[model samples]
Target: MKTKLFFVLIFTTFQLLVNGQGRYYKAQMHCHTTNSDGGYSPVDLVNKYKDKGYEIMFITDHNFLTDSVYVPGVLCIPSEEITFKRHMNGFFLSKNIMPDENFTCQQAIDSVIAQGGLIQLNHYFPGPFTDDNWEVGAPEIISFQNGPHMLEIWNTGTETVQTHDDKSIWDAVLTAGKVVWGSATDDFHPSVSEALEFNKGWNMIWLDTLTKEAVYNALLNGKFYASTGVEITEYQVNDYGTYKSINISSSNANKIKFWGPGHQVLQEVNGSSASFILQSHSYVRIELINEGILGMSNTYAWTQPVFLNNPLHMADNKNDIPYIQLYPNPNYGMATIDIKSRQAGNLKLDILTLEGKFITNVANEYIDKNNYQFLFDISPMPSGFYLLKVEFNDVSKTLIFEKI
Candidate 1:
């Protein structure tokens, strides 16, 4: 029995993380072959990975799906890197897809889903120059309804050169109320002899049975952790509806950090194992690090974020989601604003563009007991993404709504 790497997990998170029966399979989720721009052929690449101790691998050639190889012990899953205006990897795809420039990003996502595959956004961090205005920009990439949900958090091919990690971008996407899982990959594209560019990152998937179907479902459910080097011996997340408890122990990590919204470190420890009790916030993620020598950067292992079913609010009021409701949430013409809180204070309700620019004042007054039910008219506004912000007490929270 080798080290068990648990894959993506939600409802079955604890079982996969704690069950000694499960083993974590070393996976090279993304790599290229000669079929596209890689220097190594499929056979050579598969052998190279096996030599380096990868239990499972996906040879994701750019715009091409290399034939599944038949290796004795190694698992070669069908995959491809959908290189359009933006880059994405479709894992466990049944067949290769050819998307022309005329195809929209969303269309590519739909195509992958049609094949029961996962569309993971490749290194879109600092590698490419893009902004929110660009249709394929990082911001826009996450806006697609059923779009790229798995982001390449650490790409070794681009890791040593980047000024920042993709964790910031991941945090941004979470802050915007979208759920995404992180993936680390080598994106390797070198020959077997090219030691300099070989293996620097990978995804560790945990499974009881070594099968392609099990691995695919694991990745789909986010049962794995993305790592550069640090390895976790035991990871457990216990979500108890009201509060959550997280316990983790790593063999190589010297430090563990518990992070929350906006990349805030809620707790930090100096040992290999640590526990965190999360009572509030939208979600929490774990980061394990091992310090490097001579003041150099350290290695990291990032676990998928654990979202809270119920959390405390900013103030004595209620949480941003449940307590705040707008009748006809996707309003056509007129709607009713139904909102309340336990505390009473000055209120400021404003509508702003998704870019955080002030649009107009919906209301600014003092309401007794912090209860308000009024009629809101969006018929005069154009259909777009807008923010409905409520500022009361000393803290404020904003909700994104569509005016249709």
Candidate 2:
């Protein structure tokens, strides 16, 4: 009897250890409701996320906040996506304060700060307006430098063209020596797509407890991991600033990645897992590959890298890098390209057929660098799919566009 009791105790302790270490909980941070432009009401949206195994959901409707609702086994936090000329998200805000369009980005920051809420700059790189003429200008670079407590380094449904800009923003912020954290968001808006089951973007925050105040505190303190589809089983930053590692375990992951602005590679044959070493201070990201239908594959996990020391500092762009913007995607006939920089040089814009053949060179010029918009005449080209390649200052981006 003594031996049997001892064996039972050991087994119980082993089970508890397994459960305590490297546990994963899926969640979606940036979601919308009918209070803004979403299809479902706040309650319905919460239920949908919960049913999808999300442990937490932030109801960040445009310029509106919902009351905190506590549900069993899930958390429904009161939050809002403050939609000014630019957008920002404030989570766990006071029940009394409400966001409005009239509030400047700084004012919104101040409001959230007053309530001890956690603030994050949502999609700061490309700026949210989709019109060629709609120039909101980059989030007051100073506010980005000084205001927000955190920034969303990844947003689901964000096009590949804008991803370069996102990288640039993160690099700048990291080099500046700021005290900001990184986040991933779904930016879920039902009107954008007909599929109702597409709630996949979220940040997995590490907290000691499952309470609202505890979670918010953890996020503010930079204790979290963001994910698109993959989940992290273990993440650790050691005493050496030069080394960090992540271990991931998932049900349907084909390939795991440790990619970012560094010279890192995956070590295969390590028990069918992916691993890498950190070299630079840039945001490190992990990607999970998935097979899609119709010759269209999907890369699910889009996580931003966690910096080791002073992850908040912004980098310098002494070259006055030119900013490019494309608008009205899924276009009908013509589309616009907007450029902004401190100086201008030779520019070349090419449209390539989806079949990897050259279609046309739309715009080529030696223009001065300032805010300017140029329209590409696509009426002459056969439609279906094409890529817009823009080259300037030896840096370029190929923007995918659909002609209808």
TM-score, per-candidate, Cα-based = 0.69, 0.59
Residues 200-305, candidate 2: write the lDDT tens digits.
Answer: 4577766556766557545654566666555555444433446655544545556666544422433322222455555554545555544346414343544444
Give candidate 2's error at residue 97 in angstroms.
4.7
Candidate 2: worst 10 consecutive residues by lDDT? 7-16
| Model 1 TM-score, all chains together | 0.69
Candidate 1 lDDT at 63 equals 90
Q: Lowest lDDT 10-mer window, candidate 1? A: 3-12
Backbone clash count for every predicted candidate, in the order shown: 14, 18
lDDT of 2: 0.56
- Model 1's alpha-carbon lDDT is 0.70
Residue 263 CA error for candidate 1 (Å)? 1.9
